[model samples]
Target: MYARISSDVEGSGLEVTRQLEDCRKLANSLGWSVAEEYVDNDMSAYSGKRRPAYERMLADLRDGERDAVIVYHVDRLTRRPIELEQFLEALDAAKVRQVRFVVGDTDLSTGDGLMVVRILAAMAANESATKSRRVKRKMEQNAAASLPHGGYVRAFSYAEDKVTVIESEAVVIRQFAERFLAGESLRSLAAWLEDNEVATVAGKPWRTTTLRAVLASGRIAGLREHQGVIVGPAVWPAIISEEQHRRIRALMQQKAVSGRRAPRRYALSGLLRCGKCGHPLYSAARQTTRRYVCVSGPDHGGCGRLTVVAAPVEELIAKAVLYRLDTSELADALAGRTAQDEALAEVTEQLAGDRAQLEELATAYADRAITMRANG
Candidate 1:
């Protein structure tokens, strides 16, 4: 006996149980002794996802271990035409001709019964296709209206409704955005999240890929994204300003283009230069002691004659930096930098507005609401 239910939203196996009971009654009435039963709960035949129990039943049929098959319905066995054909081929190869359905009672021992099964499988496939189209259209409609897309878990920094901001998570998101913009690596940020016991929506520890996705998402900036493209403003409030989000995206792109490596392990790794060749010194360890040496090779293009002990150089540089931090000149320079940051923020906001306008025009063109020349 083979029983399968495509969906069980409540995670209850009642449908499969009912199917097996009907199949068992049919087998008893037909005077056929059942050796075993195969059940696939919440598995879709048309979805192309693996059904373990169904595959096991097919393996038994192919090996000639089973002389017959019984199911509640043809659709329960398979909704895909290709799968139905495969099943038929397996039965023929194994010489197991007896196939019974409790509801349809389609006898597979004759040619007419086989034809009927083929037609039914094709009809099921068509129905599945129609349902998929309807679902896609509904999703598109929801996206256009800036409605929250349904999912198993709520988005980070948002409540179960997907519109209300969770202030605690929002604060963490803001911290991530700010630190990321300040040149903190994604790996570093992930470590911080883990150390602080901040878990994801799935209650898993943070990873660089997951951190990148959260930081780069438009949802945190009050934007609705559909199929990876930002459609428009979202229904939810922004956790970080749109300008900050745009800057984060730009910085991420810059890093990707440069192919920058992870955070440096040594303080003076890239700071010191070779006095002989005027090239940067690469950090190397001599036995247990750390040192900076100029590399000699086609790749490095350095003279390789200069080498310095890392500890003393790093200590001197740290003292120098600390001294500079207290100087009046450094404070004056920082005041100037504050003004520059505000100007940069203004430019970033303007750039975001222009990009939004371009997106609107492109959307209008795609919808046939404007001419190509006007869009340009």
Candidate 2:
């Protein structure tokens, strides 16, 4: 039995320890010999790579070091169908039984096994996609509606953009912008808000994350939030001008890039050097393919280099990945490291603890055992 949990799933009663404990108890009563354990902590399930512990366990399974595999649930293993296919082939070849708390047992040889796995993976994928879509849609809607969706903040509230006497959080909004422009850090602003007992729309204490959202909020710039969307020219007045808003946005964008949250289309964006000159390569559109090009500009004495097609490089990468996604019986495949916690194991443990009490009541009800009546 092996257990794994991401950092997010730890310490809230979903720790990996709970999974192993239940599996260990079950293995003992079932006369099954426990083999080895693997633990992967603080790993992300969306990464599409193998955890070191998981990879080692898979290798052990192939090497005949383990006969049966137990997890709190199947999701603890993988949420990728292609990866599941690779593993199913290996387990089937070894005649290994994969037991999970929710489903009890899985036979990899049957179509039902793969179907069940596909469903779990699909559910996980759907959940992830839905979240991303929700956020994007919220931003777009906010922009179109001329409302402040409070970008980057979770359920943020507002009074008004700017005001003196009537219905406005303008005082706080202006303070946020001024502090940002004065080079006061977002963390420092969060502390200030907390010290002053400022609360978000949800009536929660201020946080660095919330402060960052406030500084980036277009609300002060006369934006409004409607249905998880942002719109402009709100019913409220502008606390800050568009130019000032841009400046704040630029600062936050810089911070996001520094924090590594910026979108990167290619992993090798800045690292790929020119084949001829030693200059950093830049991408260019060439028909259906992208080409890396380097030209010696005015500063470099106008020495030019010819562009090379990216087809060969891209083809090489695709081939390598396709080869890795192989399945048994010569079937084709394609595949992450993801974090999944086994909630079902806790259910199993709870059921076990109740089993004895339930059994006694069952016997009493069946009339096989007499229940002694206690006088009040």
Error of 1 at 345 (Å): 50
CA RMSD of each candidate after superposition: 28.0, 23.8
Q: Model 2, 317: alpha-carbon shift in Å? A: 36
lDDT of 1 by residue, 156-260 (tens): 899999999999999999988999999998877887777788889999777665677788889899998875667899898999998998898888767654644
Which candidate wins on lDDT? Answer: 1
Over the stretch 268-305, how does candidate 2's per-residue lDDT look in tens digits? Answer: 22234666667645456566766756645321211357
Model 2: number of backbone collisions: 23
Give candidate 1's whole-model lDDT: 0.68
Instruction: Enumerate clash totals for all models, in the order shown.
Output: 0, 23
Task: Give the deviation of candidate 2 from the true structure as CA RMSD.
Answer: 23.8
